[model samples]
Target: MSGHGFHVHGPHDHELEHAQAGEHGGEHGEHSGMINQIALFTAIIATIGAIFGYMGGATQANAGLYKNNAAIRKTEASNQWNFFQAKSTKQSLAELARDLAPEDKKSGYQAKIDRYEKEKNDIKVVADKMELDAMHWEKQSDEQMHQHHRWAQSTTVLQICIALAAISLLTKKKWLEYAMFAAGGVGIIVGVLAALHI
Candidate 1:
């Protein structure tokens, strides 16, 4: 219509064009928001999985250390028991000598019995303390194992969340996305508990 020789649409046409543009823009925004959220969720899942994996490894190491310490304590306790048995044999022989010896030798044997009794008591105290130490190490090992179990559970859940996230991105299902997020939330909570050694 103008000197440029190009036709311009009427007001009605302009209104229809604007409406279609707005609809398309809205759809694009919605889709982009979903993609952004999925990306963020995937990153969070990967991070949680990594942290829990490290924690699991640390717990395993602690358990092994405790087991080694327990073994050491047990060895020491066994050695003490062997020494205690030797003392017992010496005590029996001393008693037998005291009962059969002359009166002059009897007093010497009595002194030996007294000395042996004191040594046995000392050994008993040391042996009991060593056994208690071994039990403490065993208990610590159990606690580490329990914490490791929690970390393992959290790691599994995080892996599931990651898998679900992958599936969601491919299928673009909002339900699947939400489910992935839910699983990730659970995994995070479990990881926190494990960190707290609960």
Candidate 2:
């Protein structure tokens, strides 16, 4: 009869070693899971933030452009009204000068003519200034709209990159990481180029 269950002397401590290795592997798996969770959470937050940022900037730019357009219209209307008033005043002065007797009209007629001319000149200066100001504001509004559009496009690309990076962490996909990095880098470059007028 075999004293040790019909087996020759086996390698000692083999089962114990296997148990230790299994424990270590479990710990490693748990740590990896934790890391993946953190990565995913961060990416989600970044995506949400990018969306809100893009929305806010776009809204503000559009509102400002609308307000500027309204102001430009108001300035144009005011200038036209000023010109009309000056013309009407000059026509009235001419009629009054014609009604006066010839002997008495000479001095009064000269005074009235000078007054109407000065008033017309003043109104013309105001109209010119208003027109210049309106043009400047319109240019500024256009620039702001362009800037907002660029930012929105860049943000959308960044959001996509963040999502890809999160997936890479979960799956341990090296190619996905590379793709995310490339996309993010391209977006940043394009945004900078647009900003610098390139």
lDDT of each: 0.91, 0.66
**Measured by TM-score, how close is model 1 to the native structure?**
0.86
What TM-score would every model get versus the actual structure?
0.86, 0.61
For model 2, the stretches where C-alpha displacement exceeds 4 angstroms are 1-59, 62-77, 80-85, 92-103, 169-172, 194-198
Write down the lDDT that model 2 would get: 0.66
- Model 1, CA-based lDDT: 0.91
lDDT of 1 by residue, 74-161 (tens): 9999999899989989999999999999998999999999999999999999999999999999999999999999999999999999
User: Model 2 over residues 33-104: C-alpha lDDT tens digits?
Assistant: 655664765565476446545654964577597557759766785866677587767757675775664966
Question: Which model scores highest in lDDT?
Answer: 1
Worst 10 residues of 1 by lDDT: 22-31
User: How accurate locally is residue 99 in candidate 2, as Cα lDDT from 0 to 100?
Assistant: 67
Extract clashing residue pairs from model 1: none
